[model samples]
Target: QAQIVELQKQLEEVTRARDGFQTELEQAQKSNTELTENNRGLTANIDKLSRAQHEMLQRARRADEALRVLEGEKEAADRAQGSANTKLATQEKQLKTFLEANEALESDLRKQMQRVALLERRKLEQEAEQSTIEAYYQARLDEMQAQYDRLLSEIDDSKRAAQQEVYRAFDDNAKIVPPSPGGGRSPPGKAR
Candidate 1:
């Protein structure tokens, strides 16, 4: 009976040890299941993060293309502005040249007008001088004509007296006297 008691105590200790090992196994299995579920959740979140990262990359590429297009447009605009500035400078130069030409023409016109005024004044002076000369000549001519008429009248009077004396002498003597060549001779139907 002493051996039997000792054997019984050893069996009871072995049985308790087996039950404890079984309970530990069940707890281990439960902990593994919870850990597996947590792993699955973490995998799903990683997948979503990966997709978000891909979408962000696509958006970045589109933004880069848009920036390139805007830069092209800006370059074109800068070229157009440069061309316009060149055209404006050319036009301004042309306008300046035209204004200078107009000023030169105006100066030439003023000079020509002054010349014409001088010529007109000279013409008037020449006409006035010619008129004075003509008047003086006419006055001299009239004076000479008056003197010639007076001399002609005196010559007629002398000729008539000489002819009367010669006729009276010839009538008293009853002698024929020759008529002088320069006597008061008159043509037919005309008086001396």
Candidate 2:
């Protein structure tokens, strides 16, 4: 009976140890399943972060191209402004020169007007002097023509008086002389 009891106790201890090992195996299997699920979640998060980084790089490249285009436009605008400034200065200088030339022409015109007035005054004075000389010569010609007409009248009167006196002497001699048979007058100083 004593040997049988000792064997029975030994058997009970072996059975307990077997149950403890089975519990430990079940707990280890559960921990391994949890670790696998966490690893899959971490991989999905890493893929998302990589896609976001690629999108950010593409946006930065587009911004750089836009900045270069804007800088080129600004340089062209500056060159156009410089050309406009140069043209404005040239036009201003030309306007000033034209104004100066116009002023000089006005002064020359005034001088010519003064010369024309002086010449006109001199011509009027010469015409007045010529009129006076013509009037003096016309008066002298009228006096000479009146003296010639008086001399011609006196010569005609003297010739008519001498012819009347000769006719009277012939008549007186004819009365003093008598008619002869020849029917002619006697001599000029004697009676018939």
Candidate 3:
């Protein structure tokens, strides 16, 4: 009976050890399953990161290209501005020369106007002098014509008086003298 009790106690100890080993195996399997799930999640995250990095590289290349184009446009604008400045400077010089020439022309026009005015005044003075001379000469001619008419009338009257005196003398001589042999009287100064 003591051997039988010792065998029963040994059987109970064997059963407890088997239960402990079974519990340890179940815990190990649970840990392995959790590790596998974590690895799959990490792989998925790595794939997403690779895609994002590719997109960023393409964006960087495009940004570099846009910068190059902007730089070319800036150079073109600078050249155009330089050309415009040169044209403006040339136009300013031409304007200055035109203004100076216009001023000189105006001065010459003023001088010419003054000379014309002076000549007009001189011409007016000459006309007035000529009119005065004509009036004076016309008066002198009228006086001379009147004097000539009076002298001609006086000479005509003197000739008529002399002829009447000679006739009276002839009549007186005829009365005093006798008749001639031929019955004709002789002229006052002739002998028959």
Candidate 4:
């Protein structure tokens, strides 16, 4: 009978151990179900992060391309501005030279005008002097002609007076003057 009680106690202990093992198995299965759900959520988050990273890389590449295009445009604008500055400087120099040349030409023209005025004045003076000299010579020629005419008239009057005196002297003497040795003053039959 004591051996029978010991056997019954051993059987009861075995049944209790079996019941604890069954509880442990049930807890393990419940934990496994929760862990599976957590793993699925983690995987979804990883996929979302990877997609965001890819979009950021695409945006960065586009920004770099935009920066390169802007740099090229700036260089082109700078080169154009430099050329414009150089041309402006050249045009300014040319304008200054033209202005100086025009001033010099104006000065020369003024000098030429003054010289022409002086020459015209000299010509007028010479013409006036020539007129004066011609008038003086004409007056001298008129005085000389009047004096010559008077001297000729006086000589003619003296000749006429001398002829009258000789004729009177011959008449008073009352002598016949022979014209030549063969011709008497009157003919023989016609004595005067």
Top-lDDT structure, candidate number: 1
Provide TM-scores for the models: 0.41, 0.36, 0.39, 0.43
For model 4 the local lDDT of residue 68 reads: 56
Of the two candidates 2 and 4, the one with more favorable TM-score, higher being better, is 4
Tens digit of per-residue lDDT, candidate 3, span 76-162 = 655777666665555456545545555554565455456555545555565565455555555544554454454445545555666
lDDT of 1 by residue, 58-175 (tens): 6555555555555555556557886566655554565555456555545655554565555455556655655565555555445544544554555556566667767876667676
Q: Kindly report the root-mean-square deviation of model 2 from the true structure over all alpha carbons.
A: 76.0
Each candidate's lDDT (Cα)?
A: 0.56, 0.51, 0.54, 0.55
From the highest lDDT down, the ranking of the candidates is 1, 4, 3, 2
- Give one digit per residue, the lDDT tens place, for model 4 in 1-192: 444355455545555554555454455445445544554554455455455545545554554555455455545655778656665555456545545655554565555456555545555665565556555555554554554455455555656666776798767767876578546466667859
Q: Is candidate 1 or candidate 4 better by TM-score?
A: 4
The per-prediction CA RMSD against the true structure, in angstroms, equals 73.4, 76.0, 74.0, 74.6
Question: Native-vs-model 2 lDDT?
Answer: 0.51
| True-structure Cα RMSD, model 1 | 73.4
Candidate 4, superposed: residue stretches over 4 Å from native: 1-82, 168-192
Residue by residue across 48-120, what tens digits does model 2's lDDT show?
Answer: 5445444544544454454455445545545777766565455445545545554554555455455545545
Worst 10 residues of 3 by lDDT: 1-10
Worst 10 residues of 2 by lDDT: 143-152
Which pairs in model 3 have colliding backbones? none
